[model samples]
Target: MDPVNLLFLVPAALLAGFVDAVAGGGGLVTVPALLATGIPPAQALATNKLQGSFGTLMSTWTFWKAGQIDIRSMLFPVVCVLVGAAAGTVAVQVIDASLISAVIPFLLVAIALYFLLSPRAGDLEAQARVSLPVFGLTVGIAVGFYDGFFGPGTGSFFAIGCVALLGMPMRKATANTKLLNFTSNVVSLAVFALGGQIIWWVGLAMAVGQVTGSFIGSHAALRFGAKLVRPLLVVVCLAMTVRLVANPQHPVYGWVSGLFSG
Candidate 1:
């Protein structure tokens, strides 16, 4: 809220937006920054989403304007996000997220390994494998649930889902991901604000930076197309998975997370 905080946040937001636009892990950057400022974790997540919405909106708009996204039928996914996330948020109060945390590393590892092994997985800009409407509905519900319940690495989830199910190119998948992500974030933001948890000034400062960073990052994706996008996504997913497994709190932070136990 102060000038010093604003100064620190501006840079953080811009970098967060750029990372978000590039690979869908901006929260990995912005959430920690918010937490570092002594905010509660819930408020930090809510405010980060508040600021992140601006960049995502810009990224989505850029994709739409460039003919990279099919917006007319995007409503189903967007709406599903709003509904599914509301439910997920409510359910979280009763459900333990420990299982999800335990499982997600394996999921990320599998996704990363798939991409790493198959070099041509999403490289071809061919006809989509699924109908637009069905495609939209499937991912909307599944990812909406995830984003609503536990939201780290959501961008990666959407990206891989689009590629694996719809056979969409990575560039287009990233664009569409932003639109769907925006809807989910908006739903969560509304809830957080309702609970009086969002830090308005912090969200505001970060939002401004999000717009700037997203514009630049969006253009970069447009320029490089799927060739650059898919591999980078795989790498990011792998990195995020490793981070999750390590938990940053385990005795063997680097090596032991791969060995799983029931």
Candidate 2:
């Protein structure tokens, strides 16, 4: 790749890491930057997973060190996510993704509305609505599958599940989200690696930026807690929704075009 591409991608990766650490949707930045560099879409997505792993790992470590994550409690959910992501990855090879793509923007909008309008969305922990085991089997697996199948809004889904079902505070939810996100990311990365889709040099170079930005962003999250996480989550979810719908080939775009033309 040209050095000029690195100039664009590295900075984008840095910003992506920062935003992703705070909330999610880092791929919103990095994927486009990679595509703009003229890499194949497969390589761009694979390379994103490579760099994203670094960012998620860094943020997870930071959260763990701060005592925000409970690894022992999270073990089952991690395993569940592993299974779900693996299944989803395999399923994607055969299934049509258009239906899922059509539905996602609406779901994202609902999530954004929930976060924006719900008074207690991320304010504080309430009584747990479900046990961790149940949460693992349901939200964990579902979101993991979604991540592997569609590859967007995953962190938002995880964070909301933690906050709403598990009754975790915003900071704690964000911490746990990173851990689970890392698990799913690694599963996808391995598949991509097996297919030899990644560009190593680009991924490694962006990883440097990912690590640095994640470190800073995680610290910022710790310091500000819910105040920072809440608004950022809303913004990230809505932005991702827009990006999805804006794609000309996206199902939502086609549906809208048909509506207007008819």
Candidate 3:
């Protein structure tokens, strides 16, 4: 890459990591930046995984260290996510994604709306409706599939579901999101590596930026209450959903098309 693009990747990855840490859609930023590099779609996606996995890992660790995660209860869900991601990746290989693409905007809108309507409850004082195992498996299977197929609002979905359905606080929900997000990324990255689509040098550079951004983002989340986080999450999801609906694509993903075209 030239100096101009190299410069761009740093800031792009940094910003992507920060937003992802705060809300969960860093790909909304990094994937387009990769596409803008004029690489192939599969190649860009592969390189994105290479970089993103690192960012997710850093965020996951940060959350864990900060006393946000409960690993024992999370085991079942993490495994479910791994299995679901593998299944989704395999299914994507055989089926056209047009149907899911058509439906995703609605799904995102629902997620955003759910949060909007329940603003007063379910952040810190929420209660779990099922055993940890049951809850984990449910989210793991459903969201894992979504991540592997269409990934615009995966983080947002994970965060919100844990908060609303499982009655997790926003801090705990954010931490748990990182863990599951890490698992899903691991699945996708493995496939991309096997296909020889990753650009390691660029990925490593982006990872540096992502890790830095994650640390900053975690601090922001810790400092600000969910009263602040709640709306930002909704707005990001709304923007992502609208972007997907108008363009008839994955919304957040449409930016990738522009990058390659430009």
Residue pairs with clashing backbones, model 2: none
lDDT tens string, model 1, 207-248? 998888888888888888766776777777777776666576
Residue 112, model 3, lDDT: 81
- RMSD (CA, angstroms), candidate 2: 0.9
Best by TM-score: 2
Q: Write the per-residue lDDT of candidate 3 for residues 1-262, one digit (tens) a residue.
A: 5657768887888888877877787887888898898878888889888888988888888888888887887988999999999999999989988778767777778878887997764367577776677766788888898888767788988887788778887877877898999999999999999989998888888899988998888767766747656776787888887666666345445656677789
Candidate number of the best lDDT: 2
Clashes of each: 0, 0, 1
Question: How does model 1 fare in lDDT?
Answer: 0.80
Candidate 2: segments with Cα more than 4 A from true spot: none
Higher-TM-score candidate of 1 and 3: 3
**Predicted candidate 2 versus true structure: per-residue lDDT over 1-262, tens digit per residue:** 8977898899899999999999999999999999998999999999999999999999999999999998998999999999999989999999999999899899888888888888677778789999998999999899899889988999999998999899998989999999999999999999999999999999999999998889999999999988999889999999999999999999889989999999
Report the error of model 2 at residue 11, Å: 1.1
